[model samples]
Target: MKIYIITERARTITLEVADSTEIMHIKLQIMINEGTPIELQKIVFNEEELEENRTLKSYNIVNESTLYLFRLERQVGEADMTDERKVFETFENL
Candidate 1:
């Protein structure tokens, strides 16, 4: 089945999976493709968190199911870095 994954940054991505596939495997794929660490990834569907040991079938996940991906760690080079750069530039301009 094909599932839609929405990242913490609100980026949407598509993933092809099978009913027998485990949640951990999906996280592995996200780690490989999106560079998100498996330990930091939290996948949620229909307001419920998906367990790593469970299969897609266990969650009744069907084709086109939307999963929300959340990263527990702070993402580098994102808002934090940008804000720091802005502060540095402001100080430089003083």
Candidate 2:
């Protein structure tokens, strides 16, 4: 079956997976393709959070089902620097 995945960045991709595929497996694929860590991935289907231990079939996910993917936001530490490139670009345009 093919599942539609929409990333938090609004990117869309289709994945071919089996009904027996676990939710964690899907996260693994996303990690490989989108560079998102599995621990940070949150997948929602039918307005419900999909469990990592459950399979697609357990969620009654069928072919052509769409799943939303979100990356868990992490708290920025004091050592983290904000990207100032956008501000620089705006000044350049001015």
Q: Candidate 1 regions off by >4 Å?
A: 74-94
Model-by-model lDDT, in order? 0.90, 0.89
Kindly give the stretch of ten consecutive residues in candidate 1 with the minimal lDDT sum: 73-82
Most accurate candidate by TM-score = 2
Expressed as tens digits, the lDDT of each residue in 1-94 for candidate 2 is: 9999999789997999999999999999999999887878899998999999999999999999999998887545412233356656789999
C-alpha positional error of residue 69 in candidate 2 after TM-score superposition, expressed in Å: 0.3
Reference-based TM-score of each model: 0.75, 0.78
lDDT of 1 by residue, 1-94 (tens): 8998999788988999998999999999999989887888999998999999999999999999999999886566544666799989999999
Model 1 TM-score, all chains together: 0.75
Error of 1 at 66 (Å): 0.4
Clash-forming residue pairs, model 1 = none
Point out where model 2 deviates above 4 Å. 75-94
Backbone Cα, N, C clashes tallied per candidate: 0, 0
RMSD of each: 4.9, 4.8
